[model samples]
Target: GGPAKGEGQATGGCPVYSHPAQLTDNRNCVLCMTCLKACPHRSVEFNLRPPGIELWTTHQPMGHEVALLFLLWGAVLVHRLPEIAERLQLPQLLARFDYHALATVVLLAAPGGVAWGLYQLNRLGNPCLQGRPFVQVAYGWLPMVLLSSLAHYLTLGLTEAGRIIPVTLATFGLATAGPIWVAHPAVIAFLQAVSLLLGALLSILLIQRIAQQPWLRLLPLHGMTVGMTVCLYQLIV
Candidate 1:
């Protein structure tokens, strides 16, 4: 409904999905500081930093960011569930819509929960942090997590991404050649192993750098890192 008399007009907005051209047309933006200067709360600041080092730092994330990562992890699992189901020969019950819900919950509470718990383990090993939230240090562990994600997605992209193009094009009365390229199973396997092992090594180094404690004090969490990597290796390879 339109605004009543004496009410201010509603601001017009465009849906990103409906008007993707708006996002693609960045010509109107001239790097002007108008928005930053116009903010009432003065919450904006800018700084420069070295690339990619922040992911390995011990700095914790906000509560919502940690929660966001949990949800993202769940989404990632949902995206990969078909492959997972195929490998495990999941029961027919998984064909139901509820399976996505179940898988998301399981992924969030199980693997994602373990990653969050490691922040507590870090706290326990320190004992100096009494009142701080665990979310702070949790995302510090994301370098390996994100790297493994890249590796996983890269394999899928190289092997499977091209297949959809022909089907989509055919719907529009177009024809295409065979799949762009399909790497050999052995080659994909080799790349997957390299990515997983490299991620594992990076995770170990991240733990050592961020934990800054003797192994005995942080053994459990370190073990969690190693175990997670091993599970990932088994799952993918």
Candidate 2:
């Protein structure tokens, strides 16, 4: 033989089946085929080589839900701004009436509506996005949409009625209670933080369920939330 070749054993890092004892650590594993035949759990399988079963699951895919969400949000945006077909910076289209009101609604509603829709869409499709990414994106976008919408209405509020609030410096002054002056900074911060945390948690839980039964997912809940918030703004105004 070659120099020092016979001195090294060829342990090929493969299971050897020369004897039944070599296949299992349990000494009582008789070489009977009965155990393999009768076992329902399939806890033991004879794999001469590891296969690619780990990469596959029998669960169904639901990518359609994501697409539906996208469509729904698109429809909402178009519905909110019926003049979108005109005010899209098209030179010929801009000859009509002003689209500023429609543009304002779209600007206020589109971001959150689009973000929520996308979050739902991703959850419908992706099992892996069920955790932190969902939380972060949802929390980040929802409040921006909501608070900005509030600001929009607040502007309207100021226009509808003259400045009902008088300027005063005393701590007991009632002027601080109205929109003429901003609320206490601490109170605003607390409300914003709570809303963000709740929105994130709510989205995560919904997506977790969607991961289980994608067919059970629906758009009514999202639509209702959007509608309700808009209604609340209407009430506030």
Candidate 3:
């Protein structure tokens, strides 16, 4: 039988039952392959698409989803907190709080606060813009959030990942001093810079597409994207 009524079913059956094309926007899909295995017509399939394409497409984002996007953005910054605190000489000021607690606050507050400020600036520059500015612009930053995190993790993967060989051998009591391959720090830094640049470009494009506003009004968000790219570059590299 087809997907049941009032069960959150839409135009297609993909477990979540959202239309197949809309799966990019459906956060509930767990990719369990239930529909792929069960479809009688064999019409279910996967297609390769550009990352962050969904950010520019039509989808009504919920409040929680928007909030989560900010959280994800903030998470990328959370990893650099130690270096940040050190450079700014904030250890003494922050000594009263636990490290984990401070990180939690940064994770929860930083991105949202920045976004809110940018949204207000954008609205101030163009008062005619309509709708909830925060929700409207939230998804536009997804590419930045995702690629920055990827770039951050790429450093670990490139440098520390080689240790898995010797570490695994040690775990099995077969310790050896044979050389293992690790990418050069310079190479990793170059790649991280490239990743951030690409993310910033995609973010600018997505913001333009999503906002549909004049360049003058969009300047604040564009600046924010560029600023974030620079900040992440400094933090990671």
Candidate 4:
């Protein structure tokens, strides 16, 4: 059939894509494998394992994926802008626009800076590689960026998300056998510090691997990363 909408139910769950449950309308999939089998070009495939594993490893010409990740990271930065601005006591430079709105606009307008930096590093690292190096080298820095994100939000998430377990149990008329664990502020801080430092170190290592010690090129990126880490530590943690 041309359409799989009315097709028979699939055996187990939606194989619509790698992350069906993450979709807004995953409930409507009916576990149908139509999309999986109907592709004329055979572009569809399945990954039954954890997400982000590929990012943790080397893949080539990942510009599209890097773009998505940068957009996501931009959104994260926007989400925390209010707290950051408040903590910094920054004045509202744009009177007519919401600060957060302006921040988001900035993200949309200039999201490729990270990839561009990566491209430059790649050029310096490997002269023979003909492909644009942005996406390829960008993957190497993902660990640093993601770990920074975790360190930034660790305290808040541990406190807030931990309640979901107890709340869900109460909603179902069930009981928790023990009190939910909340990380002490000091412990959280220690973890956050480690995460920040680890992210910086990983980024340094990635830069080295890509360029075999292109110190001049790396100086700016390293400073930026460490500066952002310090800013986050001072403001949020």
RMSD of each: 9.3, 23.2, 5.2, 8.4
The TM-score measured for candidate 1 stands at: 0.62
lDDT of each: 0.61, 0.41, 0.76, 0.61
Better of 3 and 4 by lDDT: 3
**Which residue runs does candidate 2 get wrong by more than 4 Å?**
1-97, 108-183, 210-237
Off by over 4 Å in 1: 1-50, 55-60, 82-100, 118-133, 163-169, 176-179
Worst 10 residues of 3 by lDDT: 1-10
Model 4 segments more than 4 A misplaced: 1-58, 88-98, 107-111, 114-132, 169-178
The candidate that achieves the highest lDDT relative to the unseen native structure: 3
Question: Candidate 3's residue-wise lDDT over 12-55, tens digit each?
Answer: 44655655555656568777765554444546656998765566
The local distance difference test score of model 4 is: 0.61
| 10 residues in a row with least lDDT, candidate 1 | 13-22
Badly placed stretches (over 4 Å) of model 3 are 1-25, 45-53, 93-100
Error of 2 at 229 (Å): 15
What tens-digit string does per-residue lDDT give for candidate 1 at 34-146?
Answer: 44333444456776776445444534346776677656555555656677787788854268778767776787666567765766766666787453344544554565567
For lDDT, candidate 2 versus 4, the one ahead is: 4
Root mean square deviation (Cα) for candidate 4: 8.4
What's the number of clashes in each of the models?
A: 3, 0, 0, 0
